[model samples]
Target: MARAILLRQLTLGPRSRLQLERKLRDRNVPMEVAAALLDRFEDVGLVDDAEFARMWVRGRGEAKSLGRSALRRELNEKGITGDLAEEALEELTPDAEEESARRLLARRVRPFDRTDPAARDKELRRLVGLLARKGHSPGSAFRLAAQVIDADSGDNVLEQRPY
Candidate 1:
């Protein structure tokens, strides 16, 4: 029954060893049995945390535009940590993260004209807050939001603040 449970979980989707262990535990599988089952799955190349983290980062980045900070937290929650999480996070380069942030802001932020200083400031704050909640650093969020707003207003101002 334990083996059947593990197989059924795996067939549904890839799982980290820890996730599988939790599943077995929830089903009242014995500790020793769960450990042995997980060990065998690892030995047979089924329960790989590294691969799981990689795929997770890739999928989430494409689908959700999650920043590295958010990805790290998610990986840690899934029992993918240390080298595996860091290695997977390395795929999202600084440039890629900035691009993702820009893309996210583009979708949500409307263009603000240079004539309306009050409205532009409000919009900037809103965009910065949105990016901050999504795990982007404050400096990058503010700068990126400013750049997008500037570009939209035809000023083409470059924000060169050190992040």
Candidate 2:
């Protein structure tokens, strides 16, 4: 029954060992039975934390444009931590993260109006808050927001045109 439960859960989606253990425990599977079954699954390559982490990071990062911090928090919640999580996060390099942040900000920020200090300050705060809510550091959020705003300062018509 436990094996069938594990297999069914795997069929639904990839899961970390800890996730499976929690499910088994909920279903009243003995701890020893759960451990033995998990061991067999791992040995047979049916359960791999590293691979699950990689897939989760890639899928979530691409789909949501999430930062490393957000991804790490999600992984940690799912019982993926330490080296496994870091290895997965490494796939999202600093350059890629910056680009993603810039793209997101570019799409969101309004054209700058230096003529109005109140409006400009409000927009800057909004952009920085956007990135912060998405799990970026305050410094990184400000930098990226500023970079995108500066890049779209309308000095160059062809380059700054938004699609």
Candidate 3:
């Protein structure tokens, strides 16, 4: 019965072996039974934290525009181990981070009226807040926003802004 539930969970989504064990415990499945089921799943390649970590890094890095810091934190929260997390994070490059930041900035830049000082400040603040929540650092969020807002400029765009 516990194995059936475990199989169902796997069918729904990829799960780390540890996460499955924890959930099985919550369901009041006997420890021995849960361990046995997990072992069986591992043997059949149904539960693979390594593959899960890899896919997670790829998906979140591409879709959500998350950097290594954000990706590592999320994977750790999901029970990924340190070594595997490092390997996965190593696969992401600075270009990936920049691209994600660029995409986010393009969408967020319009809210600020570039012609008005106060409006620009307000928009920069709002954009900064949005990027911060998305897991970018202060320097990265502000710098990327500047680059996106002034793609053709030689001057520092943030300095020209009122705020």
Candidate 4:
């Protein structure tokens, strides 16, 4: 029964062993059965936490522009922890994160193009907040936001001297 349940779940999508164990628990499967089934699944490569973590990190990072911190939190929530999660996160380099942040900021600030200073400032704050929620540092968010806004405005606001 546990095997059937596990196979059915796997047919739907890849799941972490922890998630499968929880599902077994929720279904009232005996702990011993759950453990045996999980071990077998692992043996057969049907339940690989490391591969799941890697795929989760890649998919979420690309689809949501999530940073390392956010990705770590997500992996933890999905019952992926410790070295596997760290290894997956290591796949995302600092440059890749910064590039994702830049893309996020660029998309977010698109509507504010040609707006006045006050409105642009307001939008900038919102964009920074979005980045913050995605687990980016404030400094990185602000720098990226400024760079995107400057590029959109066709002026290097940071480089201009006030008359």
TM-score to true structure, per model? 0.88, 0.85, 0.85, 0.88
Q: State which candidate has the highest lDDT.
A: 2
**Pick by TM-score: 1 or 3, better one:** 1
lDDT of 4 by residue, 2-28 (tens): 889999999999999989999999999
lDDT of 2: 0.85
Ranking by lDDT: 2, 1, 4, 3
For 1-163, candidate 3 gives per-residue lDDT tens digits of 8988898888898888878988899899999999888888888898888899999999998899887778998999889968999988877887677777676666556644567888767767777777788788889888776565655443333333332
Task: List all candidate RMSDs to the true structure.
Answer: 3.9, 3.4, 5.4, 5.2
* Angstrom error at residue 153, model 4: 4.7
What lDDT, from 0 to 1, does candidate 1 have? 0.84
lDDT by residue (39-75, candidate 2, tens digit) is 9999999999999999998888766778899999999
For candidate 1, write residues 1-163 as lDDT tens digits.
9889999999999888888989999999999999998899889998889889989988887678788898899889889989989999998888778877777777787756568999889999999999888888899999988888877333333233233
Which parts of model 1 are misplaced by more than 4 Å?
111-114, 153-163
Q: Estimate every model's Cα lDDT from 0 to 1.
A: 0.84, 0.85, 0.78, 0.83
Using TM-score as the yardstick, the better of models 3 and 4 is 4
Off by over 4 Å in 3: 152-163
User: Residue 98 in model 1: shift from native, Å?
Assistant: 1.2
